[model samples]
Target: MRADRLVSLVLLLRQHGRLSATALARELEVSTRTVLRDIEALSAAGVPVYAERGRHGGFELLPGFRTELTGLNPDEALALLVAGSRRGAQAFGLGSALASAMLKVVDALPESYRDTAAGAAERLLIDPETDLLSRRLVDEEVPDAIAAEVLRAVFAGHKLRIHYAAVDQTPMWRTVDPIGLVTIRDRGYLLATKSGADRTYRLSRILAAKELPEPAQRPDRVDLDRAWQERSTRFRTGGDQVTVLVRVNPGRREDLLGTALAVRAEEPDADGWLRMEVSFQDSRHAKWALWQLSMDAEALAPQWLRDFLRNRATAIATRYGVSS
Candidate 1:
């Protein structure tokens, strides 16, 4: 596909806001004279074009400045607008700002792209629609701008003071120094340095980071990067690891361990029962396996393990219908 002329100009500007004649020419695959002429053309049109000559400097546009969509061909602009809408309404927040932003962009689009935009939108609908609509509103809902600022703060590596809601209490405002923003599964998380000897806060619980002064006491003890690694690994492997040697009927080997503790199935021995070693933790696992496996499991190593299985079985039998 041919590159849109509008997109080409923006790309050039993005790369060469302070670009040398030689550098811009190489980037655009054109002659140095052509690069000089384009710079003049942009400046004559008052496009905020500027350049500097030095070992470390070239062309650069000022930050936070955006060119008008008049630069983009109609079809390209409309396509972006429609695609953005499918992100779900609730996620768009208070003013339905996403839709409004799209309107501005679409208004800028030339007439030629209007029909194509409508046709494309009609054919494409957001499916399996899952988004912020599924959750109950908190203080962040009272003002949506907070959510935007919190995201910005996280990216900036700045401290945040947000009204944080607890699981079973009233929300309280807190100041946290952010370390890293992590995404576990689908949702985003701000891993930050918190007061009272903790250094992390969940973004969902934060109402907004309206203001932040400085860290109360940044932990010199814990390495946040290392802690993040350990936490992520534990999430996959369950809690503390323990090996369970289950003497099971040989043929049931694969199905037993695979369906049970979510461990790799092991090879069976000559005995009619195949001893499967699985990683687990505490007595809770022993109890869970005892009940689920029922007669199939007989703990082989560590006499305590076999005793655990038996004790759990007895407890279940005692607790069955004790309400009477």
Candidate 2:
């Protein structure tokens, strides 16, 4: 880590030409005393570093001394800089390291392109705080200590003991073989197995965690994308799911289909309506999703669902028709 710090320090000086001790300390996220010691180390190691005295003076590399690290074109440099702004790495407990790496990336660019690349990146936005719907994106916080433990087990191929709070269930301790960690939509999940059965746990719901000494019973190498796909498919198809036959206005066909899990069959009706057999996670999900389409979609089969909707509509009509 010290070696990494030393290399970053050299890159910093190379980029800026000169920086005060306080400035170097701030950029390196280390104490000024450490920066001074590293400067001494650099000079003693034959680097052409020299110091200047006075309030306006600071440390600088000897004139004409440049490290050969300018390989990126302006667009490539800007792309790297923009990607470095992502907060996803923070969820994996690499926030500080990501920041340091970004600094090095910017510093490595050619002097003529550095400022321009950085300025261009600043003008672009990724993952804005709020969308047009005025919904704010929130990042869940995982304590540094807990994240470190999770990452340690994941990388070291060890089993993990976690206190997980499943939805609608009491918190319980689980020992899982951590297959991998995945972050989606700013939330983190541990894709693991318990007794060789696939299980996924949200990092936010991990009330507590501990790493076990036993080696994890997972593959030597994992394809996370494939693993996620398989798990997602199983979850979608293997629940207490329901299938409904529904008639929807042809114009709202896409809207109805979008809410349903899948369309098993479709046919055009006499009045230009579309009859579809759709699947939903469950009856409640079916009712809720169909309710969103109001009169445009009607559940035609599963007598119970049709009766439920009829009763609901009747109650509403009854209420409106009552005399004052």
Candidate 3:
């Protein structure tokens, strides 16, 4: 493990040119003392490592010193291959580049690992467009030109102007400071800031985009994952959410959960039926999801929901010429 740590330390220095012990420790998830020891070990191991003393000084490798350490074992190689098979890169218009990089990774792998990793990756499927019920997964379509312009702005840390269409609203032009891009369930979103206020725009709804020359005013570093999580939480809790107590067949538990915003509690009854307290966006959402389960699920609380379903079912039966 120390050998691995030393190798990582060297690579970090090589990639970053110089790193303070604190910075190295943070990146390695170890203490500053451990980073110092690793640096000493690398030096004793004939590595050309040196240090400079100043407020802005840290350890640096001598010029032109390189390590031939691939540092990847068979399992690591296999994991990379399998992850590369995902379609996420395609959303960014990098499908061909991903394929080329994967080829190079396989070629660089040890001969014994090369074939095995590739074969294992071939057997694993990810994010298929259809489910077992044969329901087609609808993917939002974004024009390549618009996506390219958005990507340029996000990566370049520039302002972006977009012609956007919001639901049931007129299309309008807006300028935003690009933060990052996120894709969920094949739907792409642009996280941005407008006049210092956070904004999220669906990529599919962007009719056009133009990258601005002005530099965006934003923090030097951003924790994008945290930002996205906070935004998602606000969106989920801000709406008129409805809580429903329902009894559902165990076989349809997943089907019910798929449409629920959150599940408060769940337990199995003596009859093996599942009783769950679930939250939906609103009464309409609850009704729509529960209705899909039909006889398999029953809403116990909220007499109004029961009445609504009963009336609907009765209407349907009467329409079919059956007595309700």
Candidate 4:
């Protein structure tokens, strides 16, 4: 099992630019030694997976060695393209050299497969009005098996072993319970209650992870749905560095509190508004938050929040002749 996994790990990293041995172990559910042995196997097999030794080190394939993708049906071809389109979708098993390899596979296919591939091409475009990315990248795979395991580890009382990364982070291993997966199509993500506060992590950002059963699972009131929603609204387009502590209107407090955008920062007000603080990095994002509030919410703050809103009101008056 260990030796077989090493080969797969090598292929995984070779195909996907880099991964730490620890990350490989998490994905393979083995010890670090096992992953190392696997790497040794690859080196012996003429697959050049080199180790990057340092704070930034991880395994990467030797350049100029490209594997040819062969034996794909039309469904496989279509699946490859569509999968490549999604963030982190490439991990599903389409090798790294996707396009050129795909073309090669298509050329070798029976005429029927070619006809189907053409039909798929004509049938639909993934996103007609999608914003064109300056640089498009193929996402690696996140098998449903792995996804399901994460949920089990976090919500189902298990610990996770992961190959994880962060800004300036060297990919390393982690043992975290699957908290809950935060679905961001562009990137695979999760929210784990690691280090006390629940941390949201992009899945691909995590090189690998797995769950454990011992130490027991911690209890929480993490409504995955609510958390996901909260995460979505926590950012402002152009916002000031203020945490807008607001009391929702008496009539709308419950409804507002239920919303994903409503960050539950405090208690309900005597007037029935739920009091909470909304943090912003700058005035632009702050104004954007205020704009979202429309009439249902008000900013109760460090004076600046109110002043900003007032100025916004004045600007509105000056622009459209509404009120001063």
Top-lDDT structure, candidate number: 2
List runs of model 3 lying over 4 Å from the truth: 1-73, 107-113, 133-136, 264-277, 300-311, 322-324
What's the CA RMSD of model 4 in angstroms? 14.5
TM-score per candidate: 0.41, 0.73, 0.65, 0.35
Model 2 whole-model lDDT (C-alpha atoms): 0.88
Q: What digit string (tens of lDDT, one per residue) describes model 3 on residues 1-324?
A: 677567667767765788899999997789999998888887888999999889999999997776332678878988888878777766665565576566556656666676787788888888887899999877677777888899999999999999999876999999999999887777788999999999999998999999999999888788889999999987777678888999999889999989998999998977889989989988888889989999999999789889999999999888999655
Q: lDDT of all predictions, in order shown?
A: 0.59, 0.88, 0.84, 0.62
User: lDDT tens digits, residues 87-141, model 4?
Assistant: 3333322233344344444444556666677568666666332456645544445
Task: Residues 1-324, candidate 2: write the lDDT tens digits.
Answer: 899999888878887878999999998889999999999999999998999989888899887676435778898888888988888877777788888888877776667888899999989888887898999888988877788899999999999999999877999999999999999877888999999999989898898899999999998999999999998888678788899999999888888877787888999988889988989988888988888889998888899898888898899999999987
- What are the RMSDs of all candidates, in order? 16.9, 5.0, 16.1, 14.5
Please name the candidate that would achieve the greatest TM-score relative to the true structure.
Answer: 2
Provide the clash count, candidate 2.
0
Decreasing lDDT order of the candidates: 2, 3, 4, 1
* lDDT minimum window of 10 residues, candidate 2: 63-72
List where candidate 2 sits over 4 angstroms from the true fold: 1-68, 249-258, 301-324
Say what the RMSD of model 3 is: 16.1
Instruction: Quote the positional error of residue 235 for candidate 1 in Å.
Output: 3.3
Clash totals for all candidate models: 9, 0, 0, 33
